[model samples]
Target: MESYASSSARPDRAEPCPRSAVSHGVGLAGLAGLALWTVLAWRYGMDGPHAGIFASVVACGVPMLLWSLLVDRVHRRPSTGIDWSGPRRSAREGFDISVVKLAGLWATWGAIALFYGTARWYWDGGYSYAMQLFGWAVVPLLLASIPYVIWLDRYLIEPRDGAYAFGQWVIGGAAGKPPEGAIGDHLRAWGVKAFFLAFMLSITPANFANVIGWRTGDPLAGPVELANFLITILFMIDVSFATIGYMLTCKPLDAHIRSANPHMAGWIAALICYPPFVLMGNGGPLDYHRGTAEWDMWFAGNAAMLWIWGGLLVLLTAVYAWATVAFGLRFSNLTHRGIITHGPYRWTRHPAYLSKNLFWWLSVMPFLSTTGNWVDVVRNCTLLGITSAIYYWRARTEEQHLSEDPDYRAYHAWMERRGVVTRALAALTRWSGRGSPAAHPERG
Candidate 1:
């Protein structure tokens, strides 16, 4: 099945409005305030003994509320006309400069704050029951800000030229209208969403249960516990973002899914890695720590070394989450809202997959198991290897599907030539070849 690009002609495009700057500024200020609050809370340790709730409100809730109000007011004004000539601007020129700068700034600061806050929470002996309850209660409220922010971008902050930044990543510059797919494509979209929904539901209880376990003073010791806690939190964040991105915001305006992967092999490989289907596989869910007897054996006994490993795991997890953050309201497995070329994508074509696979290898320790038998090690390694291969296939299939679009093709070419991974590999090959017989043909 071939995926087509959107039409070049869009009569509905809107003109640039000076009022958009006001909305953009207000939205940006709110993001800045939230980021600052998070940083301050982490740095100063939330003031008093009972200050967590207040801190959360100040850090996340208040600014978002203000931003929402300002955005609503901005949208109440008369609508602007479409700017047909706006498409002539370069990709960089097309984006609202204020939005782009603010989104990047806020995303960077927010990620740093979240990482520091989460690490501090775990390292300082976890949270009390009241504190945990307060924290969890505040999560949904904080997440509520996402749709509002997206709404502001859609209706107020973004230019009528269809140019806007989604949390540090800019999309839309001479990009055509999204293609209307066949009934089969629509069914595929529904099917993909259904699978993600099921996946999210299946993992929800386990993540929350972990939180409860931490609150109840479960026997979580050293880095393993820390790693597990961080993973759970990151997973929860992903689930929330992915669920909202897939279910709520997927529409013709900003969230329109351009295409779904029609390859059966891609679906089978990707789907089998999650949920009840994962149970069908012997290795179980591509997560090395789960469904294995040797989970604890991977951690070092030394606290310092364990902490280092735990920190590394958290970093990897953060990178994985950063990819999702870059996607913003467009994240999903089978659909392509747009091609992201910033954030973690700036470094690797598949940052999430690469980091996730590395994380599994580190945390799962496939080389070591309970039994001394090499067979067990081999089996475990094979399972993980297959899972990794599946992701590789998924990436390739996605690339094939996306390559049909000119924007994606341009992005792919740029990444191939200038991306970090590509450059690093080229350097490595050059270094290795320098010492080889092939480099010294006369001596040979």
Candidate 2:
């Protein structure tokens, strides 16, 4: 008999089937439940503080249970190449495979569901009790499908000749020989993980406190207060996702550490915008509060204007969150975990960075400073400009690294030719006698 992994001999190789109707139904049900929960919460208020937490569990658990039942049924059947039934089969042989696959699926899904559900609860200001419940119930169930997904890939979906075991990948095991890398590469990975871990810790709880304030009827009497609230929530989600993606996942999801920013300039430019460093040296001007009073004064007594500005701020923050969500479990800074082309990425190459900078420009009103001094105004604007420029540089460096992969190269070309922002940028550069922006090697 031909090996399962061999593509040359067998014409009709076994493959894992596509998601079942039951799975689709479960997903739809989850969405509908979320919508209903949102409407009800908005109308009558939540079931109390822990309502979202409860909803999150159900949302994640039910779908998982349903999907597992399906997988168990399918696996029990005697499929052509993946038959578990045999005249000489021993009870231990069946037990090992079944237990390992199920256990792996449960563990992975449980972690994902809990983290995301908690994040959602905080984001909704604990008022979206029903939505939180949906998150709790649905996310885990969705994630629980992974182990069976691997099983299908190995036994039914792909040619299994050299396939790695489903159990191995679940526990962060690699299939082949360990990748060779210099000590610096390992150090960089550790550093990157540590930085994001600290970033999350610093922001998550602080933002959650802000959410609680919002929920408890704290006075958001002005546009600045509302904008700050929304901004804090957005950063909380971003930092949480980044922290989990970098620190919690199995080895397979980890970005292959090709290289770190060897240039001192890169480190200085990026780190200065974050904590500790942001508190030191010329970084004071980069602080978001440097112009907040001016912004508040400009919108004073103009409720309509405040509302419009606040709405724009929220929209920009939503875009940033959309990009983060698109990354799922792969989000992190200064690292490549394959080029994502979905969500906000479909419209622009740097949606998160663009949205974030725009938000700061509006919220900070860098053109106006508290001191009313020309020098302070100039310094604030310049610092913000430099921050924006730094992010642009980060985007360029990321593209340069990702271009080494074929998928990223194709994505780059497609974005250059068709993406709204890149296309407009190329045209502007051409109009300015700079030639096409795509002419730059890194642009591709």
Candidate 3:
């Protein structure tokens, strides 16, 4: 081992990165688990069968849980609402809390099930897979909730949360009703999970299958093929991490939803980007891909241009996926589990949104129509612009929600002052002798 004369003598430690809520260690733990699983799949000639695809949840979740609990000691955080030092709730009180929580939770699950059963789209295409997964999971989840809720309520700082309030309303009527907005809050939080979780699950199997069965043809035969394949891998990583996040939103992991977005605008902004409601989908109002050809097609026969363009597309996707990875097990939409200030987040508040929008613009090149019709070109470009505007709307509403948290506000300030993109733009403005307009703060 080598010794340093002083702290200043060590270049490696010269500048410490800004602290992030989710530690690099925890993210690495999840990545390591995922990497190991990938290695095993490749070694064993796996094709991402149903079992193998579902196993990804375990592959990513277990290691993250272990690291967060054993190493980071995340359970000790005040945000978790757990008080290990204090005596637990009384058996009777705990039972009461658990009972109400169970009532609320089971009712919520039932409602979600009813909604799924009635929704024609949920029964169609990829969503059918999510419905199947949820069907397979229901019994296990119902059986586990009883003991889990009881055990958790014993240590929660205050267990009479929205769920408990809803439960009270369900059983005790108006005489023992909770606050005015408690049930609404409970619904919004669960709604976020229910809507997004199903979508994540729906995409996960296909991505996993694509990645594990990535041996089709020579991927490197062309830049576009390689890029598509690589994008599949990045998407797999994003889906795997996001699936773990939605499933592991537990108090024990200190990743429970502290608050869901309260604004209808915020919910609307996010929900429209997802399935069954997405306006940007094929033939929807914002279907920009209608007249656009693939990026590879535009640069066909030009190996150099295709390679460069494909590489940029891949980079944008990597950033988008990195934004998810940075969340560790806290990557839910419309909820503030915690504020993260590292990884791609350090560069921008909404790296995923930014990069995804950029990817759509570059990859689709909406202005370039397959039919070479200026009319189609204008329509596609305009629609894609509106789609991007929706994302911007989402970012703003999310910022409005998270701005209430001091931690998020601090991160927002740091990004405004020291973010890589901010600094670069500042330099460019100065070089061009132009005054830079003030940019609004954002949240990750």
lDDT of each: 0.50, 0.50, 0.80
Assess the local accuracy of residue 4 in candidate 1 as a C-alpha lDDT between 0 and 100.
10
Minimum summed lDDT over a 10-residue window in model 2 is located at 1-10
> RMSD to native for every prediction?
15.6, 12.4, 5.7
- Model 1 residue runs over 4 Å out of place are 1-181, 216-221, 279-300, 426-444
lDDT of 2 by residue, 249-357 (tens): 2222222333454444555556766655663234375554554364457787898897788889889998887666555444666655545665556566677877888
Compared with the true structure, model 1 gives a TM-score of 0.56
lDDT of 1: 0.50
lDDT at residue 418 of model 3 (Cα atoms):
47
- Reference-based lDDT, residue 108, model 3: 88
Per residue, candidate 1 scores C-alpha lDDT tens digits across 1-444 of: 011111112112352111111223332343355446534544554434233333223433344335534444422333222222324444444344435434433454355336435643322322233334435545674566444434443433233321222322433343323234343464566567645643443343344343334532332655677677777666644544454455433232245556777777767767776644663255455444333453345554667767777788889998887666555445688767666655666556677888888887877777777767777778778878877777777677777667676766665555444444454555665788753212110000
| Count of clashes, each model | 4, 22, 0
Residue by residue across 1-444, what tens digits does model 3's lDDT show?
000001111123344434687987777888788878876776676654463455457888788889899999998988888898864779898897788888888988899999889888888877888898889899999998898888888888888888898888777854386889989989988888888888887777777777777675758777888999899888888888998888888888889888899988998998888878889999888889987898888999999998999999999999998989888999999999898867766656787888999999999999899897999999999999999888878888888899999887766665555455555565666788777634555442
Winner of 2 and 3 under lDDT: 3
Q: List the residue pairs that clash in candidate 1.
A: 6-177, 13-82, 14-82, 15-81
Error of 2 at 184 (Å): 3.1
